[model samples]
Target: MRSLLYSSLLALCGALWARAFAQAAATQKRSVPPGFVTTNGRNFELDGKPFAFVGANAYWLPLLNTERDVDYTMQQIQASGAKVVRTWAFNAINETELPSATETGLTYYQVWNSSDWVVNDGPQGLQRLDYVVSSAEKHGLKLIVTFGNNWAAYGGIELYINWIYGAENATHDIFFTDPAIIASYQRYIKTIVERYKESSAVFAWELVNEARCTGDILSAGPNCVPGSNTLKTWYSQQSDFVRSLDANHMITAGGEGQFFSAHPAEYWFDGSLVSDYNFNGQAGEDFAGDLELPNLDFAGYHMYPQTWYPELDFPGSNFSVEEWGLGWISDHASAAAKANKPLIIEEFGVTGLQNKTDIYPSWVQHALDTGHARVMPWQFGVLGLTEDGGNRAIKYSDQIFRGASPNDGKTHSTLTRHKYGISSQRLRVFKANALDSH
Candidate 1:
């Protein structure tokens, strides 16, 4: 959805990260060596060498209809020089509620039966995710697999509340506190972590995607208070749960870097006074507090000045989007340094193509200068791909992107049929091993 100018520096040094594995089909062992990418103060270290890199968000990589879909998508991402690919490892639906992708035999990690929810680990389920990890391992890419979502694209928090309470339109903040919801989410994550516990391709286990005090399906419920102590305790406890499952791979709370505060007007960005709820913790982000969590490995934030702070783009303010974006990045960078943890701009993008071309280069450069660990734009685009039946908003369709040609491979009947192919094994091993000589 978002784009950034290519970074040769990221390509040159990114692939040093190691660890994780893949179940090629069912539970077959993969070839990626067993070594983890660890954090040292403010940088990612693989075998004790700095492992900063560039990545892209391609949430649909594991949601495609066939192996041919995986082939072309992985190639384009690999060609773009991204070593890390963050994606959703989740999908949900009640027994009667069927998504269209299900009709096409696409995979969903979980589904609600008539009585209760169930994980679909058969060929209809986690095997698809297995192939994605296998492809990442073969293609020299590390994956940051998020367990669930805040929004309801593929069965996010709304689905959980609906399934649990037998009601529609429940708020998401309750997801942080409710005991039943917490236990349910833990079961889902435990299934995934134990499945890939020894795999060398998994870089990190992200707890959720852009979790916050509010969500799109409904307003904040009474039990869900924004800017309260809800998230800090949840993050600490859940991270402990994941750490207990896989001690080597890193764990992070996938938040938008919103810090909590009492006085909304007190927080300032770049010496400017603004009481925006985003910075004041009304959105339930505590970037500094997250960094200090005992089990979290790093901290992350997202940016979209055009949408999150539209005033910067107004004609009278004389403030450009990119200028404001730089300030946002600067604030998080300083916070990361203070906390002695690595930072990642997990998602960032502008809306217009011209604005992106003018803005993204400086953001990448600023990350380099500020000592941040990674910069992954909103998404890695592919030619001729349709998302959510092509109705998903073109939220960040800026910066002309180049992608591989449309998918041409034919569909197959069984999982093993598509497990191995030239494209699947076409990992950029040279770049991944670029730092081996040292």
Candidate 2:
């Protein structure tokens, strides 16, 4: 009798699993909110509304360069006030769809990887975008799509001969300078933007990753295209393209450090601004009156302090969590003023270095204190997921809220909801009271 009962239970369990799998398949097809923009809501807004984002970028996409891990990592991110998640086009969109493999619309290794530029539309690329867009919606997170990278930053002889210009080998080449490159890139961007236009999960269409100056292009160029000039031209073209197709959504360029400095070369896109921040550059440069970039609709900044500067590294390693917090806070204040726009602490977090420490609270407090930039701490489970694990993953129990581990089979999540207790209301109230006195 006992044996028979166990067998019956096993059969029921198997049936349930099969049914659940089918449901998931159905859900994928069922229309999901592509992504969202907080034009006027509390977390985020569209035109004149309150639009804030507490998010992070999924840097390592394993299947495509650690992207397989992103689905898992996002579970932890959702728990950490991350309403939006960013991904590169190569890692997230269809790349090889272009006419020639030499075309470059969006690539993974714009900074480091060296893959032949291929026409997008590969099954892998399509699947990747659908999976991410669908998955982000399922998990209540928004997607910020970046079209390009600053690969031009690491320009050298080899880069020039092989990568950009494609000398000896016709295969490896950057399609940007090639006149033929325009249509294909336009197609790729359109495909993505069109597909996800109705997606409420999509926050905004970011034209490019970083608007690196022409001089800063990794490989030297002929006319020496100015970063601002090149970006402005590119942004204008793409922005027009996106607007023509999808007029409902917002558009922005991934402008980080450029907005903080006083360099005239940094100026571009006269209409609306989507400012980006990196805590490493000119730490305390004021954003409002200091930079004169007050025409911003929204301010976005990246916060990966410890990774860039080892001195500012988090606790259990070199720098104390408190010290790191101060560094981030100072940067946040500067950018917030210059923006005079809603704040998006776009990219901020501790890296997954072997010597990992939990300085999340340091990050939380800074955001809490200012109430200026909506805080999106560095990351969720990118590093290791626990103290017992290797790299720089946050503790699941310490930071995350309710969420399942996408990588439960391989890694345990150390993230918890407790870490995010720095109340937004409390932070605002505190700042207000403190300010009145002054």
Candidate 3:
């Protein structure tokens, strides 16, 4: 009958409408809005909802050779439930301009050619970063791109100082005060920020990887003594400069949470001479003061009490690893609360020999329980590579130290995989705690 046909047509129309509505809702959920990440009180907000995460450091992501490698790294990161990643955005290098073959058979190394300082082009340049950003988007991971380095590994501050002051005259302090060096750094920052300003995959911009004054180019020393205001001023300038360029993203001074003299006296682990060299109250970094900067969004610190203060008979002693780590977290979290910002453990890990696999998840639980935003372990390793073959495990180092042997290849690879498992566990903890907190 005509009435039966009319009813069937009405049902079909209703079904089509419902399907379209469902598809639209799914699309909206998948698409993160522009400037999607923002701070709400002490927590991060993304797409109008609170965002808490367990992130990891993939410092060498851009150095990976192919798109497949980059994609694989992201897959591993996502598999571990890490929603954010910290990576290096700078690689300062000395290049030589070869003369025409007919003219001369001589080559000269150039360190200061402005044109050669291309941060956005070439195979190993920002094009690689572009792929990282895109792949991270594909894998649903966010990036915290650090602008420079404090160590010499990736042509750090020393390279910039050497370019302007020559190797003999270069000092880490000059990188902060010298007008020419500051200008050069600002130009590099401008280049990268402008290029990636529109990408939602970028979660934040860190000023440097463990920004510190290491005295001069020749000495591998602890941070420079904190007698002057140059370092603080430099942090403010760089952070404000980034804010000026990109109004959407967050900023953090990538300091080591080396507290100044005002740090609580109880948390001071001055039991060893190494502490004097590494954690002296005068180590030119003020975590609390740095957070006071208006442009800086959050605070970050690394926890390596086992390595940094080894004299404190940990493991079996009253000062257990968990106690030591929890103390640091408590102190930094208190400081962040006072600053009215969220705290993130940007780096923390124990060696394979220490056998503290549970510590990673414990730290994550402690961080979430104590109102901290997130905890990112020291690093995530690449697949199919051993320590001897140049894959640095989270805890094992390929670089030989004075009294320690290089990490045993197979053992370290196993430990690295085990650490990945720990990270996966930490993610579970974060998820469970996040649900409870909400």
Best by lDDT: 1
Q: Tell me which residue pairs clash in candidate 1.
A: 18-35, 19-200, 20-199, 20-200, 20-201, 21-199, 21-200, 21-201, 139-427, 258-285
TM-score of 1: 0.78
On TM-score, the leading prediction is 1
Could you tell me every candidate's TM-score relative to the true structure?
A: 0.78, 0.54, 0.74
How do the residues 256-289 of candidate 1 rate in per-residue lDDT, one tens digit apiece? 8886645543434568876777667777767776
Model 3 spans > 4 angstroms off: 1-35, 96-120, 215-224, 263-280, 313-319, 384-415, 418-438
Ranking of predictions according to lDDT: 1, 3, 2
TM-score of candidate 3 to 2 decimals: 0.74
Q: lDDT tens string, model 2, 36-103?
A: 35332112343433334445555333222134445566665665445566765543222332322123
Model 3 lDDT tens row, 1-438: 111111222222222322222222111122335645877556676887657676777776775545775787677677655678998887655554323311321111123453235443655456778899999899988999998888776567777777666567455666777788888889888878998888999999999887776632454223345545456789999999998898788889888887765323443455632334333446577777778888788889998877766766555656577777887787787788787676788887776533443454456556655676476766665444322243322211343222112333212222353434435455344434433432
Clash totals for all models, in order? 10, 73, 0
Per-prediction CA RMSD (Å)? 9.8, 14.9, 12.4
Instruction: Report residue 187 deviation for candidate 3 (angstroms).
Output: 0.9
Worst 10 residues of 1 by lDDT: 20-29
Please give the lDDT score for candidate 1: 0.67
Model 2 — which ten-residue stretch has the worst lDDT? 23-32
The candidate 3 region of ten consecutive residues with least summed lDDT is: 1-10
